[model samples]
Target: MSGTWQCSPAELEVHLGFRESNPQSKHAEFLGPPFLTVCCLLPSFSRLDMDRFLMRNVTKGTTTVKRKKSLDNDDDVETAEDTETMQRSQKISKKNNFDDENEPQTERIETLCQTFSEILTTDLVWKKVIKSNLDLSHTILFSKGIANTVMELLEEEVVYFTGDLAKVQVFGRWHNIPRKQATYGDPGLTYKYSGKETPGRAWPPVVKAVRDLVNRVTGYHYNFVLINRYKDGQDKMGEHKDDERELHPDTPIASLSLGQTRDFYFRHQDTRPPKKLNIDKVQMPLHHGTLLLMNPPTNRYWYHALPPRATAKGVRVNLTFRKVVPAAASSSSNNKQ
Candidate 1:
C-alpha cells in the first residue's frame, strides 16, 4: 500500500528483529515478507499497471513521502493498476487509524483521573488521628533502642547543601540560593545525608512520627520526607501549593509542625475575596506536635503559606512527609527555588 504503515517504534523494532532473524525466499522477497511489508506490487500485474498503481498509492498515502525509482521499468515492476490499488488501500487504512487515535475516550480517561485523585488526597478525619499518633511517637524518640536507631540515621542521613545558594521563587518572589532544590522543592531543613546508600536514614524520629501517624491515620506509606528548619521567626515560606510535577498527582501530602507554632494561613487559589483559614480553624494552638493533612481538592483549590512573624520566635522545624514516586524525577527547572 502507498501510505507508511503507522506503527509504534517498539513494534517497528520487533519487526526489524523479525526481519533479521528470517530472510525471505526468492519468490516472496520480491513482493515482501509474509507479515511486515505492504503488498503493493503483485507479480500478475503488467509493468504499466504497476506504475499506475505506484503513482496512485503514492498520491493517496501523502503528497509528502518522496519515493525515488524509474517508473518506466515496466518489466521489473508490477502493473500500475495493481500498484495504485494497494496504495489507495494503505492510505485509507492510515487515515482510519489516525481518526481512531485523535478521538477522546472520555469514560476511560475520567476513570483514570478519579483513581489518581483518590491516591493523592487523604481523608479529612485521618488528619486528627495522625495528630494523636505523633504524640505517641514522641515517647519513642527518647527510648534507648529508638535513640540508637535515630543516631544511626543521623549519621547516615545528613545531606549538606554547600556552595552557591539555590534559586527559590515563591508567588513571583525570587530566591536564588545555590543549593540542591530539595526533592519536590520542599521548604524544610536541607539535612546532609551520608551517602546514596543511606537514603532512608533521613527519616528518623520526627520523620517516623509523621510516617507512623500518616500510616495509622490515613493508611498511607510515605517513602520520602523533606525536613526544613527555620532558625528564627524571620525565616518563612510564602504562599505556594505543593503541586510540583514530581509528586504523585493523587497522593496526599502530610505536613507535621514541630517546635514553635507559627501562624499558618490558607487561601483558595481562584476565589475573589479569597476564603481564608488559620491555625484557629483546627481549633488548636498550632502547638508542638501538630500534623496537617492536605487532601486532594485542598491543593487544587487553595494555596498555603507560613508568613514571617514581626517578632523573632523560637526555632521551628517542619517536616512534610510525601509518597514520593521517584520515577518522575525530572531535573529541576528555573521555576523552582
Candidate 2:
C-alpha cells in the first residue's frame, strides 16, 4: 500500500475513494468528506505503476525550500495543475528529454505509460512466445511516428565506427572482418570478437532508450549492446553461434532492427534427426522497427547470421543487446559460452 496518502475532495471521491491528487504540490489537498461508495477504491494505483507515474508527473523544484515550521503558501503544495503540466510536456516530447540515463529504464518507460497507461503492457504489436530450445519472442515494437522517431535517432545520434575492418585472427591467420560495428556497455565489458579483445564503450543516451523499450517489452535487463551497421547489400555477417565465454548463457539476447529489412539466417549447430529438419536451416526476414529476442539453449545450439543479400540496397542497423560478465568474473563461474 502507498504510505499515508490523503484523498482530495470531489464527487468522484465519494463514488470512489481514489482522490484527484495534485501533481505540482508537495501533497494531495484533502477538503471534502470521506468517500463511502466505491468500485475498488484505493489511494493510488499499483505501486510499480505509480513509481513510474510519479516520475513523469514530478519535476525538479527550482529552489530547495526547507521544511518550514510553517507553510510559505498553499502554492508550495503539489496538485493536479503540476500533473497537468507534466502530462502536456510528456505528450510533446517523443525524444530523449530526460538527460540522466543511469537511472532505471523501467522508471523512464513507466513515465511514458502515464500518458495512456492502460495500453503500456500491450506495446509489443505482434508478440509471439516460443516454447522450444530457445526462449525466443518475435515482436514488432514501433509503427508510424514512433518508428520514424527511432530511425531519426539512429541516423543522427548513433555514430558508427567507420574504418578499415581490423584483421582478426580467425582460423589462426589474420582476416579482415566485414560490416561496421560499434559496442556500448558498462566499463570493463570486454569480449573476444574474431580473436580480438573488443572492449565496450560507455552507453549512449538514445541506445539506452532503445534498450529500455526492449526491457519493457521482453522483461530482460540487457547491459551491453553491440550494433552492426550494414551500409548496404555489400556489408554482411557470417553464421556463427554466440556461444562465447563472456556472455551469460541463460540471459536472453534482444535484437532491435531499424532501417532496411533483411533476411536473417539460422541453423542448428549439430546434426539432428529428420524430425528436426524444419529447423536445420531457416530464414527469417527481420523487418524495420521489430524486436527479436533469442533465449537460452538457442545460443548454445543455434548459429545465426545475415548473409550478403545483394538485392538489399538500403542500410540496416541492428543492435544485439546482451548481458556480459566481466572477464575476471566469468573466469570463476562455469557459464555456457
Candidate 3:
C-alpha cells in the first residue's frame, strides 16, 4: 500500500498495521477508528481535502498559514516576504521569461479524455489538433511534403542519423527535449538544424507533416522541427523548452507523436509549497498518431517532459515543429532556381 511507503509521513498510514491485519484474519472486522486516529495524530492529515480547502480559502480571501516548520526564523520570514514580492514583480514585468529552446517546454499538455466523437464534434474555438495554425487542406498537403522532404534528406545523405527522441538519450533519461530560449530543447538531442550552417532545403515532407500537424492545432508556424526517435521504454527525453532565438516570440511549438503511447508530464515553472500542481497524477498518455499543441503562453508558467516508464516498451517517434527564417533566403535567394 502507498501508505507503507517510507518516503513521506503521509505514507505511514497506508501501511499501518496492514502487515499484522493480514496475519490475523482475511476478513477481520476492522473499523475506521484506528485509521482516523492515526490520521488525527499526523500533521495536516486530519483534513481530507486540505489542499483544495486551502486553495479555496485563499481565493475566498481567508488568509492563514496552516503550519510552520522549525526552520522558520525572523530572517527566514523576511527572506520569504522579499522572495514573494520579487516573484510578483517578475510575473508582471516578464513575458515568456523562461525561453530556453534547449530546455523542455513549459506548457502543461492536456489529454482530452472526452470521447473522440465529442471532441471532434464540439465547436470549441480550437477544434481539431493539426500543425500550428495550418488549415486542414494545408495540413494534409504539408504532411505529404514533409514526408517527401525527409526522404530526400536521407537520400541526399544529409542526415547522419535519424532516430526518435528516446534513442539518442541526449537529454537526461527522465526529461524531455527542452526548447526554451535559454536552452532550446536539449541541444545534445535536438537535430543539428543550423549548427553547421549548411544551405540545405527546408525540412522534408515527413518533417513537414509533423510540423503542419502542430501548427494547425497550436495556431503558429514553427520554422524548424528537430525529429528524435525513441525505440522502446529505454529511450527518454529530459525537461527543457524551445525558447530559441530563431523561434518567434510567443510561438507555440507543436509535437506530433507516432507509434507508441508515452507519458508526458508537466509542472509549474517555479514552486512554492502551496503552488505546486498535481503534475505526477495528471500526465497525458500521449497516444500514437496524436497531436499535442502547447499554448504560446504555456512557457511562461509551466514546464513539461516525457518521463520514462518501466511498463513502456517499443518505438515511439515525435516530431516537434518550429519555424525558422533563413537569413540568406531572405536577402538574395528569393528567385533563384
Candidate 4:
C-alpha cells in the first residue's frame, strides 16, 4: 500500500484482482497477470525495485507452498542442501572403509606385541622328563587365555610360503606340503630340507615376543624359528631330525606347541628292523603351550615325527626355535657362490 508490504504472492494475488486494461496507462506493458497487477496498483515503486521485490517474494512463497504440499502428501522431498549433506555423508563412510582395509602392517604388529606381552606369564611349571637328553622344563608356558590369544595372533600375522616354495620334493617329484610352514630369524640365515632352501624372514612382533620368552626360560639364545601350522589331524610332519648343518652343534632345539593336542613320536634311528636295539619309540602328547627342549643327543639318535591322526580335529601350530651358526651359514653361502 504505502511504503512497502511483506505480503505473500498468494495474498497479493487475492488482494489485487485482474482489472480491465487501460490503453493509455504509463506502465500498461507490465500489467498482465494477476500477480504482476501490483505494478499498476503500486505506482510509487520503480520498475526495477518492483521486479526484485516480486522475484524474492515469489520464490520464497513457491518454496513454502511446495514444502507444505510435500508434507501433506507424505512425500520425502529432499532440498538442495539436504542432498549435498547426504552425499558428503556417503563419501565419509567410503573413506572410513578404505582406511580400515589398508591399515598399516607395522601398527598391527605392534598391537599384537602389546597384546601378548600383557597376557603371557613368566611362571614356569616343569614337568618330569621321561627321555634322556630331553627337557620338558615348562609344561605350561602360557595359560589357556594366553594360548588362545597367541593362536589368534598367529592366524592374523603369519604369512606362509606360496607357489613352488609351498611344495616339498620327496623322492623325485614335488608334492604339496601337508602343513603350512614359515621361517623367521636373524638376517642371512637359511634352513634347507627336502631340496628346498628357505631364507629366514624378519621376526614379526608377536613371534619376537614369544622368542624372547622362550630364550629367558631356556637360558639359551636362539636365532631361528621354523613355524609349522597343521590345519587338522590330516596335516603332519614326517619322521625326521632337525639335524641341519646350519644348526649350532650341541645346542638344544626348543619346540613350542600351541593349539590342539597332538602326538609327537620319537623313534630311535637305529631301530629300523635289522638292528637288535631294545630302545622303544617315545610317544608324547604335545599339548597346547608345552615347551619341549630336544637336547643335543636326542636329535642325534631320535627321528621325531608328527604323524597324522584321525581324531585330532583342531588346528595345531608348532614353533621350533633353533640356534643357527652364522659362520656355518656364511660358509655355506660362500661355497654355493
Candidate 5:
C-alpha cells in the first residue's frame, strides 16, 4: 500500500466511491470520504483532492485574520487623527476670539492718536500768556465738525446727577446748583466742594477721546473730568479756587470749552476785600472749541469766575480735566471723619 498499486476499475469504484465511466482507461477519479482514509494510509494513492481542500481552508482563515488586524489598525489611526484635529480647531477658535475682541479697539485708538497728531501739527493756534502766578496757554483744539460731533454725543449719552447731588450747600444754606454737572474718572475718585461730594462715574467714550487728545497735546495725564453744562449765560459760576486736597500738587488743569463764548476773570487773592492790593484783574473770553491750560500756582494765588452776561444766550459746556491723587483723596476723607 506504500507504493503504487494497480487495480481494476470495479475495485477502484468500491474502495474510492466513484464509478469510472471508461473501465478500460488507466486514470481513476476519487469522489467521497473513502478517499480521505485511503490517502492517509497509502502514500501513493490519489491524495490531491484532500490536500487542495485543506490548503484552501487554511489560506482563507489566515487571510481573514490579516484583514481584521489591518482594519483595527486603520481605526486606531483615524481616531488619533480626529482627536488631533479637534484640539487644533479649539486653539484656532480661541485665537480668533481674542483677535475679534481686541484688534478693532487697538486700531481705533491708534487711528485717533494719528488724527490728533495731524490736527495739532497743522491747525493749532498756540498762545502763551503769563501774568504773575497765572501761567496760561490757549488754543483752538477742535475743528467745527469734531466739536459738533462731541456735542451730539454728549447730549445723547451724558447723564447729569439728580436729587441731593444736584444741589450744593453754600454757607450753611442748601440751594439748587445753577448748572448741570457730572464727574467722570477712574475708580474711587471724588471731587468735594461746597460741603458736598461728587463721586466719579465711569468714563464715557467721548470724554475719554477728548482726554486722550488733551493729554497728547499738553503732555500731561489727567484722570478726572468735571463737566458743567450751563443752559444759558445766566447760569454762572461764582469766584473760587480749585485748590482741593484731592488734586495732584503742581499739575495743570485743562479746561475745554464748547458752544457759547463766556468771559473768564481771574483776580489776585490779595486784591479782594480788606487787602485791596493794587493788582489788575485778568479777563479772557473762552470761545467754542477752545482749550485753556491753567498751570501750577494759578489756582493757589488767583480766584477765577464766569459772571452772568445776558448777551451770551447760547448754552455752554465746559470740561475741566484734572489729576486726582487717590491716596490724598482717602486721607482727606479720613480727616473729615
Candidate 6:
C-alpha cells in the first residue's frame, strides 16, 4: 500500500502459491496479502521466514542481484556495496560451477628444451654417450660437426703468439718451437712462459661459444684457451702435464682438436709409486673435429702429450681450455701481456 506493487502478482500468483491452494479459498487467503521481499527485511513474512527464503534463493537465482541494483538507484556506475555483492555472487557462481570433470581437467603448459646432443656437440639423431677410460686419462669426445664449425670461425682471422722468446727458442737458435701458440682469455690475465710475461687475448666469438657449450656439457667454465696450431705432424707437444700454478687446481682442462687426426699419449707421472705402474701408458688416436675433455686428477696424476705423428698430414688445430684461479685475477690486473 505504501508504494505501488512492483512484481506482477497476477502473473506469478500460480507460480508463488495460488495454484496449490484450495480453489474455495479466496486469492487473498491463499497468499495472505502478498507483500514481496527482496534482499533485506520487508513487511510481509516474519523475520525467520524471510531470512530462510532469502538465504535459500540468494544462492540459487538472479533475485538477489536485481534487488541489490534497485538500492543503487538504477545507476550504471557500481557502488562499493554493488561491487561486494557482485564479488559474493561470483564466489557463489564459482562454487556452484565447480563440478568434477569426467576425467580430471588438467591444464598442460607446453614447453620445449634442447639438450647438448640435440643442438650442438653430438650426433643429431643419437644420444650423446660419454665414454670414460679412467686408467690414464678421463676423456670424452664431442662431435666432428661442431668441431668443424669451431675451426671455421677460428681459422678466419688469427693473431699468432709473439714476444715470447723462450717459447719459440730452445738454445741459441729459435728452433725448439714445435707449433705456433696463442693465448686467449679474460683481459689482464698474464702467463709467464718463454722468459716473458704473455698476457691473454680478448676472447673471440668461436672460442666463447665453445666455452659456453663446454660449460653446458661438463658443468665447468673456463676463462682461457691456449690455442696451439700444429701446421703438420712435425708440430708436436712434449710429454708434460698442465700443472701450472695459475690454473684452478681442481678444474679439468678441455682440449678440442680439429683438422687432422693424431696420436695422443698419457703416461703415469714417473713419480707415482710402483704399485700404480700396471696402468702405465694409455695411447689413443685423436680424430679430427673431436673434443677431448681431460678431467681433474688427470693433470694431477698423469703426463700427456701429442708425440710427433710422422705420417700425419694437414693442419691440426688444438684449443686447450683452462681456468685461472680467482686469486690470480688480481695479479694479472697490472699487465695484460
> How do all models score by TM-score?
0.41, 0.59, 0.40, 0.64, 0.65, 0.55
Tens-digit per-residue lDDT, 1-337, candidate 1: 0001224444332222212111231111111111111122211122222342222223222322212456455345434544565465445334333223233434323322222232221222121212211111111011111222222333334353333323332234553321122332223212221111112344434344435545665567776676655666666554445665555666777666655556654444443123343221111223343456666655555545555554647756666676645544323222222
1-337: candidate 4 lDDT, tens digit per residue: 0001233443222212111111242221211122211111111122222222221122211211112132334454545633443354345334333223244656545543443443223223344445654333334455343465567778887898898888754345667877888989988887665556778899977788889878876789999998989999878775566776778877788888999888776667566434567776666677676777887777666666676667889999999899889888777667766
Candidate 2 local distance difference test against the native: 0.52
lDDT of 4 at 184: 92
lDDT of 6 at 163: 50
Per-structure clash totals for the candidates: 44, 14, 92, 0, 0, 3
Deviation (Å) of 196 in candidate 3: 10
For all predictions, the C-alpha RMSD in Å is 30.3, 21.3, 22.7, 36.8, 47.5, 37.7
TM-score for predicted model 1 compared with the true structure:
0.41
Error of 5 at 182 (Å): 0.3
Alpha-carbon deviation at 272 in model 2, angstroms: 9.7
Overall lDDT per candidate, in order of appearance: 0.38, 0.52, 0.35, 0.59, 0.61, 0.49
Can you write out model 2's per-residue Cα lDDT over 1-337, one digit (the tens) per residue? Answer: 0001122234222112122112242222222221111110111222122221222211122111122222334334444544544353344343333323353645544433332222243322343434346455675454323444456556665766644334433234544456667778877676554434555777666677777767776777787888888888767775556766577777878888888878765556443323344543545677666678787877776656665656789988889988777764356342424
Can you tell me which runs of candidate 2 are displaced by over 4 Å?
1-119, 125-135, 162-165, 171-173, 272-279, 327-337
Which residue runs of candidate 4 sit more than 4 Å off their true CA positions? 1-122, 130-138
User: By summed lDDT, which 10 consecutive residues of candidate 5 come out lowest?
Assistant: 35-44
| TM-score result, candidate 4 | 0.64
TM-score of model 3 relative to the true fold?
0.40
Count steric clashes of candidate 4: 0
